[model samples]
Target: MTQRIIKLGEGYGDVFELFTLMEAMPDRVDRLLALHTIKNDEERTSLACIFKPTNQGNFHPIYICLEGIPKPNDQRNKRYEMFKALSEQFDKPIVEFTVPPSETYHEEEQYFQQIIAVLRLNHLLPPI
Candidate 1:
């Protein structure tokens, strides 16, 4: 199956767009993931939604909001809070983990490829 990478803008505004995509296709939502990483010595999170592949096509699209949310609970970030709320609304728990920052990779594509590998190895995503 082919997986499409869709990246939206950062911060709270972009979160609305992510929610809208989910709202439009509740049944397509397969799972949620929260990737935690340390960037510039601060804890950050990347919220992602892996939607099911098309029944008639070999496309599995993952919508991700990059490391814009603060991971610390003591720090209030409405964007993360909104995502948390929606996760509860859909009853899909966020599968979280700490990973190497994007800077560690030579390019953004390499970073995402690593993530896909992890997802497939764990069976969150099917082997192609």
Candidate 2:
């Protein structure tokens, strides 16, 4: 099974696209995640949804809206509210955790690899 992060964009307006993808394929939805981090001295969150691998290709895609929304604990935002609503709508709890800021990595790929590692360690994603 191959797992990959499909970045939608920074949470800004791209968040709606993530919602559309989830709503359009609710059955394939596996998990919802809230990755929190402090960037530039501000607490932020990245919203992501993991989808089950396709039957034919076994390609597991993790769709994400990278750090753009304010951390709910620090300040509530409409985007975060929408994400919570989706979690309730899908009957899936939001698996949230604090992570090192993306800036910690020299490349975007490295950052994603760290996230994948965390997921596998927690049994959120299947181990290799």
- What are the C-alpha RMSDs, in order, of all predicted structures? 1.4, 1.0
Which pairs clash in the backbone of model 1? Answer: none
lDDT of 1 by residue, 67-126 (tens): 867784787777777778888988999898888988899988888889999988899999
What's the count of clashing pairs in each model shown?
Answer: 0, 0
lDDT of each: 0.84, 0.93
Model 2 residue 115 CA deviation (Å) reads 0.3
Candidate 1 local Cα displacement, residue 62, angstroms: 0.8
State how far residue 57 of model 1 sits from its true place (Å). Answer: 2.2
Kindly list the per-residue Cα lDDT of model 2 for residues 63-121, writing each as its tens digit: 99999788887466889899999999999999999999999999999999999999999
